[model samples]
Target: MSFTGSLVLSGIGGLVYKYGGQQSERETEVPVGFQSLTIGFFQARIRVFRTRLETLSRTFWRQLVETSGYKYPIRGVSEMFRSGAYFFPWARAFAFYLVLYLTIAFIYFCTILPVYLALLAFLGPIGFAIAYLHFLLHSNMLTMMVMRFTQLHNSLFDLALVHNGKEIFVKTAIQSPTLPKRYYVPLNTYYFWLNYLPWRIFIFGFGFTVLIVLLLISFIPIIGPFIFNALISPFIARIYFSRFLRLKKLDNKQRNDEFYFNFGTYVSFGFVAGQLEILPFVSGLIYSSNSVGGGLFAIKALDSEHAAAPSGATAAATAAVSGSQARQDTTVA
Candidate 1:
């Protein structure tokens, strides 16, 4: 009935659906008596599941290190601070939101001060604790909204990818008229508001509601919040890949499938990114840096995938990039 419980149940169901459904066909092929078949089926399932678990664990650690998600956020923040252009956007975003938050907080404080005093008089220190928690929750809600809507950090993410040699790849993809249309999904304001915005709102609402429940369960301790973040981290991690996914031109279903296929990597990346995000007061700055880290991770991961891709596919990608370069040169000539 709890948020954690629901997550656990869903995770179990997902694993079963992902792996268990194959048993019927495999079981039919075994060609054995009922008793032996049952035993062999259980044995095969256990072995297969164990192998998958081990693979996922290894993938998690490898991705975590490769992505450098733990330190990228810090690096991103430092770079933003050092660069006037990057720093300006972050400052502007922070200042704008801070002023807005203060204006609303002032109004709320004025209206709630009398109620707080009455509660304190009747409930002693408990009322003060309740009020403090209320304020913390309110601030968190504002912080999340700002983080989601402010597009400032995404540029930082792109900058990171460009620095790591994705510029040519992305540029080619953009220029190549022959590239798959999916790879060139136009991301204008209309798309953002009409398509991306609504989905994000739904996800944010559901995720934050679960988080609030978890936080309230152990408001004074770190345990509940930690668990909540870890459980919800894969979703958070995917946000870091939004730009990269757009480049690949995956739809919602394809994107979700991609994440599910690389569940370990996503979870590990999200866990580290989520930890960085949990820092109070400076989350906007941290989030910006995390974007840089995500870019670095994505580049590394994609490079690895490129190496592993079939020779024909690699050749096609190369042709796309080369063709784009040729077209550019022709235009200049």
Candidate 2:
């Protein structure tokens, strides 16, 4: 696989690791595309589930307040849950946008490109290179956005766990809510260079060198191309994965563990998906869809639990305060 392809595959694996365990085992057999839709459906379900959880959380909070004689504030918790819920739909929309854009870009490149080049006088290597660069830049932007969305999702998970008195696995191996700042700052800095002038010149020069090497090695038969790629692929993937691990909040030790674990899982899943992709009917679709659906279900459940606990506590406190005030007024009168 290409460097970008590996990164994308690894990302999917990481997401599954983060959320897939919560889904029913039966639901995990479907393919990714189907699973993606199921995830969207589950996302909708989570919205509803979140509402119910919010109600329950408020109630639980009220009870806690009464029992402990503590103040439970509903406003802040309600607002936070509301914001978190908004993120789900926003993420869904963003995912759709990426899918749509990729489809359009593919069509333009494959279908329109040849025709446009034939008709235009200026269609040449320079034009093609520019177009390719544009695609690469756009892909990078999409990747950054996806990372940000995942971070937001993780934050929501943390809030939910904290609210519910659940212990979050906060060790190095886990993606913590605390890691985005460290990764994003550096990533954004790199991204700025990636998009700017001198860097693009450097990339073009590097790409030309690589192209020349590939052309030279093409004379050495099929094995030469494979050998070149094999040498380069691991280095590229390692750098990308390292950045990804940092972004996902894994420290050095944790990242090393997850790198091996996720790399193995990714290869396994990719093999299965690739095989299914070549199959006659809906086999691949079924597999991918199920995984995505299960993941969505799991995330929804976690968020529901988190939102419920806090809301429940707040509700209990409100009830207690109202009761206390009523009794005090009666006694005074």
Residue-level lDDT of model 2, residues 1-333, one tens digit each, is: 122442464467555544332212221122224453345434543554464456555554443233221111122224333444434543553464455346544654565345434544376776566445444433332233233223323433333334444344323325443442211112233223332234347756996588557534522322333343333332223332333344344333344334343343323332332222222123212222222222232334346556766567888998589545433221111
Query: What are the models' TM-scores?
Result: 0.55, 0.26
- For candidate 2, the per-residue lDDT at 208 reads 59
Please tell me which predicted candidate would have the highest TM-score against the true structure: 1
Q: Which stretches of candidate 1 lie over 4 Å from their true place?
A: 1-68, 78-85, 99-134, 173-227, 313-333
Per-residue C-alpha lDDT of model 1 across residues 203-272, encoded as one tens digit per residue: 6799668866754553332344455566667767776776676556443334544665577667767777
| lDDT for position 13 in model 1 | 42
True-structure lDDT of candidate 1: 0.55
For all candidates in order, the CA lDDT equals: 0.55, 0.37
TM-score of 1: 0.55
Question: Which predicted model would earn the best lDDT?
Answer: 1
